[model samples]
Target: MKLVVLGAAESGVGAAILAQKEGYEVFVSDMGSIKPRYKAMLDAHHIAWEEGHHTEANILSADEVVKSPGIPETAPMVAKLIAQGTPILSEIEFAGRYTDARMICITGSNGKTTTTSLIYHIMRKAGIDAGLAGNIGHSLALQVAEAPHSTYVIELSSFQLDNMYKFRANVAVLLNITPDHLDRYDFKMQNYVDAKMRILQNQTADDTFVYWKEDEHVPNELPKYSDPSAKCGFTDEAQPGSAGYAANGTFVVNAPVHFEMPLSQLSLPGRHNLRNSLAAAIACLAAGVSPEVVRQGLSDFPGVEHRLEKAGTVNGIHFVNDSKATNVDACYCALESMTTPVVLILGGKDKGNDYAEIMPFVKQKCRALVYMGADNSKLHANFDATGLPTADTHSMRECMEHAVALAQPGDTVLLSPCCASFDLFKNMEDRGEQFKAWVKQYGEAK
Candidate 1:
């Protein structure tokens, strides 16, 4: 069969490689310049690929297409393919077709990376032959092509879930749903919610759906499910019949075998992380992993980078890199986790964020605010009347300088932008790495 892959980055290149390995006629195309390493791979493998432009004729000849999650459905090329009645599959869907691995897929607006990593940690601790894929580690298609494991802990995004149809998760984890990435969803909450619900699409009675019980959008959506038995719900607050809950600094999961651990033992902090812990633990237990393994994984997991990761402490001021906090909700979690007064770095490509959601936390916890992005007018306007000292800058260096000036001995300098990083940095990881680098170079120098 002719297989065409779009956006020749990690996932797309991986899919092309897997398709070629499976004896399919493969062609890869990217509208932007393909990275040198990826171009080399295509050349070495003798697979056909093109960069900086899409040849419509070549792409149109495919029997199937694998699309990278980064591409929006609204792209002219994609829309043209849709008009031609050609089916498009996400990298996860294309990769899933070739593997018999038990899929443990995790998705949410936030906390997904942490939960996915934690689950992967627990599965390995249990001596399970597992591979980390999806949004976190290597591309699933690449892993399936080279060394496929018996199980996979996949960190899925709503974009990845959108094009997935027949791919079923043995264990599906829905962390929470909030207003995020609405621009891609036509500025509709229901559309974004529908995209997230696709994770449950191919699930069956034997499959487990572990989700956050307290999420505002989840309960309303749960009624559509015909079977409640498949659900393993969790909450940070007490919910008597929930599969997991946190109380008195302890996280308790009542499934497979009852287990409990003090919240103090959890490597990640904040109430949001407590909720992430519950979802990961319940999913692990449902996968037949012992409670002991879950406990060990929860305790030993250092934490995922860019999600409230501690950069360093200098002159009694703590620096935190939460560059992954790309939405109002994520920033709320970061703010809530702060024990000391915060010199918050906020602003980026605003995703129609409602800053009102975080205003309460900001009023209570924020010592000063530094706005950094291609545009900072919205933030300055919204925060000006709050009477909390605020400064605006366009670069990460200026952001740190303002933060350093505002920070005191017991202050925390946090880079939780609450918006997309594309305005200033390549992505969240790039933003986070720069934050850490600057903190180490400049902040620690003092």
Candidate 2:
């Protein structure tokens, strides 16, 4: 079988390696320059690959194509491939056909990484054989290549769901939906929402859809995609169903036997993360995790890095790295989680952000604002009436120094850029690491 892989990043490379191992004739093509590390991998394995071009003739001849989630289905080459009647599938869907692992999948506009990581953490804590993959750690395909596990906690994105068909999660989690990645959906809210709903497309009655019952967007339109047999819900503010709710400070799920744990006992803080916590707990329960394991896991899980991770204290002022907050809605989540007044550092490549959405939170928690990115005008324009001290800094170091100079004891300096990090750093991880390093230096100076 001739199989072609697109976008030679983590997912694409892993898919190519897996296909080669399975005796399928594999070729990898990337429209952009492939990373040196991935290029090395392809070379070491003698895998045929091309970069900076998508040889049209070669790609369209394949029996199937495994697409990296980052590539849209609307690319001209992709359209041409479709026009030629060639099949394109996500790396996840392609990989799933070969694995028998019970899948635990997490999705939402936010909190997916935290919840997915937590479930993987708990599964390992409980001595369950679980592998972490998808939008988080290593590629799921690579993990499958190394050692297939009894369970997999996958952090899924709307992009990954776009090409997936016939892939079913043993447990599916929907955290909360808000306007995110709208550019990909042609700037339409419903189109993006519809993309998120795709996670439930193949779920069955025997399967489970664990979600936040109180998320404003999910509940109102969920019935459109409802599957009565798979319905399971969780809410921090109310009991949404017969099970998986916060009643008496615990998330309790009734199905597949009862499970419960105190809400205060969860290690991850904030109303938003609590929602993530609730969804992860329910997924664990549906997968047959005992109440004792759930309870222990919830209280012990430390939380994922780059989503409100602690960077250490300089004097009495704390620095937090939330560089993963790439949109206004995610910024709202980060701000909502803060206990102290924040000298908030935010900015980057704007994705047509509606700063009005976060105005209320900004008016309340932000003591001062430091912007880091290529474009700060839109942020400044939206914040005109908020009356918080604001400054535009072009890099992470300047943003940190300016933010620290404005902060005093008890004030938190948060690096929760509500925009993509490409303007100032290579990506969110690079942005986050720079923030952490500066904070360490800032701490030592005091």
Best by lDDT: 1
- Tens digits of per-residue lDDT, candidate 1, 359-431, equal 9989999999999999899998888889999888999888898998999998999999999999899889999
Which lDDT value does model 1 have at 382?
A: 89
Candidate 2 RMSD to the real structure: 1.9
lDDT of 2 by residue, 1-446 (tens): 99999999999998888888888999999999998999999998899999999998899899999998888878988988999889899889888988988889999988888989888878888898998889987788877776788888999999998888888888888888887788788989888888788888777778888877677778777879656547777656555364455676766666556766667788988878777777777788788777788888889897778999999987899999998999888898888888899999888988777888778888888899998878788888888668888888997778887998899899999888878887777788999999998888877777
Which model scores highest in TM-score? 1
